[model samples]
Structure formats: structure tokens, C-alpha cells
Target: MSFNITDEEVKKLEDVASQVRRDILRMVHGCGSGHPGGALGCTDLLVALYFKEMTHNPEFSMDGKDEDLFFLSNGHISAVLYSTLARAGYFPVPELATHRKINSRLQGHPATEEGLPGIRMASGSLGQGLSVAAGAAQTKKLNGDDKFVYVLMGDGEQQEGQIWEAAMYAPHNKVDNLIGFVDYNNAQIDGSTDEVLNLLDLGAKYKAFGWHVITCEKGNDMKTVLETIQEAKAASKQGTPVMVLLKTEMGHPIDFMVGTHKWHGQAPNDEQLASALGQVKETLGDY
Candidate 1:
């Protein structure tokens, strides 16, 4: 099934993406440390989900009744996620400026201690979110709620033994309501995923684990991202979980940062941030 996204909506998504990029920079710069590469790479996907696809009301609590649930397995990218959520009305966008600062609800990694409206679980330890998402999916099933549980994980995170354990369990338990996404950007904090821990033939691996694997070669492309997610949603009907390997360029659209592992947890200095922000227009007024 083909899904059509209007030009106006595309413009809106681009606007949101720009604001998210700004927020990421400001958030990281404010704290003096954080992950910006994965955050930037995943910006468009978060914008697409919150602005278009997901059935969510940011004003509502995290109980998620009549709404979709999102879990960020790559929790280090909290800047992008928090910005997207705020822009989507999950909370005041101004709060993003306090990200990673001491006593702020937006921690270096997301935590439920603050009881933030959009965040459901504490993450950042890695390899645990899939299990958390699986548990949420099961809860939704038990409650007779037909909402979807979405999760995003990094490609390097695939090396975690727990991810494979979750992969093996989800399908066997018939967790069809869950959809997992891998930000297959190749680069990790240390180096390329291939260099650190190769995840060759990831699609085949997901298939082997009983998931219907889909690939999105352009994770930064708004239209392709939306279409691929729509297709995955359409294809989830046979009691098997779905996984999409999204190939993204870390720090995409920035000449200096793209395709490098150095940007994974580094913050751009004043000049670099200015240069990066100049490349992405502020379509939506910066908060």
C-alpha cells in the first residue's frame, strides 16, 4: 500500500527537523557534553513519528491510552528525542534548553524519575529498551489495547546479547504489535560498527529471529522514512514483530560531521554550532 504525504506536511516536517537540530545543538552546548551524532541522524525519524504517524496527544499523560508508545533504546541521543517530544507538544519547548544540566528533568539519558510526560522508562544503560518495549506490548495486548509499541536502537547496540534475546523472544511470544527500528548509521562512539562489531546481513539476522525485516536506505529522507514506516505497519498482521534497518548518515547534512564516529558524543563548539545551524534553516521559530 502506498502512503501519500502532502507537500505542506513535508514542509512542516522539515520545519520541525530544523528546530530539533537547533534544540540538539543548544541542549548539548548547554551541558558541555552529550551525544549529537545519533541525535542528529535520528531527528527526521522522530519528527515524522510525532508530527505525522503516531496517534498521540502530548497533553496526555504517559499512560498512553489511545496513543502509541515510543522507546528510545539509544538513549544517549536524548537531545533529539526530547526536542521532538517538546515540539510535538509533549512539554514546553523551553525546557529543552535545560537538557543535561544538573537538577533538570532531561538527564544525559532519559530517566522516569522526573515522571516526564513523554518518557515511559529510564534508558541509557543500553540493550534493555527492547525488553521494556516487549513488556509494554504485552501489557497492551493483555489490556485489549490495540496500540503499537515502537522502539529505536543503534546498530552498534546490536552487539548486545540482550537484543538478540529480545529478538528471539518477541516473535515466539507473538508480539506482533511491536515495531523495532535500528539506526544503521554504521558509525559508533569507537568507530564504524563494522570495525567495532560487525552486524553483517542484519536483515537476514532479523528474518532468522522471526521478524519481518524492512530496510530504509535513506533514513534522513522524510518521504522514504514515512513510506517505509507505513509499509511496515501495513505488513504487521501475522503475529510477528517488524524491524527496519534504517541507514542514516550520522550528523547528516553537515559536511564536517557526517560519516564519522567522533561526533557520536561530542558537542559542537560555538563556531561549529553556528556553521551547522546556518546549513539548516529555522523554519519554525526557535524556542
Candidate 2:
């Protein structure tokens, strides 16, 4: 797909993102538990991908041939992924109300056993998604598909030793068809990522690992996100893998939830939900 998007298209995508943020707040509030901070922070990038960037078929398939594929590495924020998938026509939008419910397809983390339309694998463990994405990308290469594989990982997940192993393997094997992201929100459940485990100069680390690195300081902004992703896609398949260091605010537009790690896995109460819903306009109507 072409990366050049019109201003009108950006406005439409912004509308979809607003509705998605509203969906995240409602789903977490309905369940009384979830990771809202990162979900809300990552809304723009997900919206841009499903709505405007990715060449995916919401018709849903496990093989994922002839299309760009995305995997959520930090699956704690399943709220954003579910909402984005539903809004993108992968499933009924009303299914979002069942998030984290008993036996619901929209579980706390993405699961393959549920046979959910968009989910290809179960993903909640911290450091495994990059490996899965690398394997999928390699398969595409071996099959001569020429499509791209994408994955999103949390900055806190960088603390895991397995992440470095995948980092080394992908570049050394010339997995140039893969594009990965690290959500550099800097906050985790215990505290700031720096306090828990300082991932000093993540971009430099990736560069040293023989990967092309792109930095997007304003990950929450729709326009900047589109441009950065376009740049990343253009950089793909050039004999080196690409990584985007996405800098984002934890709670994003909501005031009370922003600026701290406390909201990492905390759900909004009735009043907080109302306040958050009030902040994000319900452009496409609630699910």
C-alpha cells in the first residue's frame, strides 16, 4: 500500500482513533481490570496501521499470505488490539463489550485457541513476540512472498534476555522483511523502566545489532505516526531489518492517568471512565 495519505484521510483516521480510545476506556471499565495506560498510548499507531497503513485482509487467515502481518508483543494492552481489530471490520464492534469476560474471545491477552479472527498466536509473555515475528517473516521470505512482517514490543520487555537473542538472530540471518517496534513509554508496572531496568540508548543498541533504526518522538500524534511508519516501510527489505523507537506518554490524552506507572494495570472506576470518555470524542459511535 502507498504511504502517502491525504489530509482528509488523516482526519478520518483521527476520528477512528478517537473512537478507539473511547473503546479502550469502556472495555477496561466494563471488565474492572486491564492495562489502560499503554493501550491508550498506543492507539494512534494501531489505528494508523489497520485503518490507513497495513495491506491486510480483515477477512482473517492464519497463513497470512500476500499481506502485511502484525503481532502484539506486549499483549497486556489487548484492549487496543481488540478495539482496533473490531473497528477495522475483522469482527463485530459490539464484541468489544466482552473484553476480559469469562470465555469471551476478547480475553485479557490475545489467544490463538479462542480462534479469534485476527489473532495468530497467544501473546502475553514478555519477550517472545519478536521471535515469532522473525520466524513468520523468515517463512514469508522462504516462500518468496515478499510481504512484510511487523511486531510491537514494550520498552519494559527489553529487560528480558530472550529479546536480545531475537535481536541478534534476526539481523544475522538477514531477516530484512521484518519491521519491529519498541513502545518507549518508559513506564511499567513496578515503576519507570529506568528505575526497574535502565535500557539506556535503545536506538544505539539496535544500531549496534546491525538493524536500521527509526525514532518517532511523537508516537501519539497521528500525522507524525503515519510519516514515521511510511519511512519505516520504505526502509524495509534493504538487507537489514528496521526498528522504530516509539516515544509515547503512558496515559496519553487523559490527565489523571498520565505521568505515572500506577495506571499501568489499573482500570478506571465509574467516575474516571466518565472523565476519560468525555475527553475522547465518540466519533464513530460506541460499541
Report every candidate's CA lDDT.
0.89, 0.94
Q: Which tens-of-lDDT digit does each residue in 1-287 have in candidate 2? A: 46697899889999999999999999999999999999999999999999988899999999999999999999999999999999999999999999999979998999988888999988999999999999999999989899899999999999989999999999999999999999999999899999999999999999999999999999999999999899998998888999999999988889999999898999999999999988999999998
lDDT over C-alpha atoms for residue 160 of model 2: 89
Off by over 4 Å in 2: 1-3
TM-score of each: 0.98, 0.98
Q: Ten-residue segment with the worst summed lDDT in candidate 1?
A: 58-67
What digit string (tens of lDDT, one per residue) describes model 1 on residues 1-287? 76878888887788889888888887887778999999999999999998998888888676797678899998999999999988888788888878888788898899889877799899999899899999999998899889888999999999999999999999999999999999999998789989998999999999998999999999999888999889888877579999999999999877788968999999999899889888888866787
Model 1 misplacement above 4 A = none
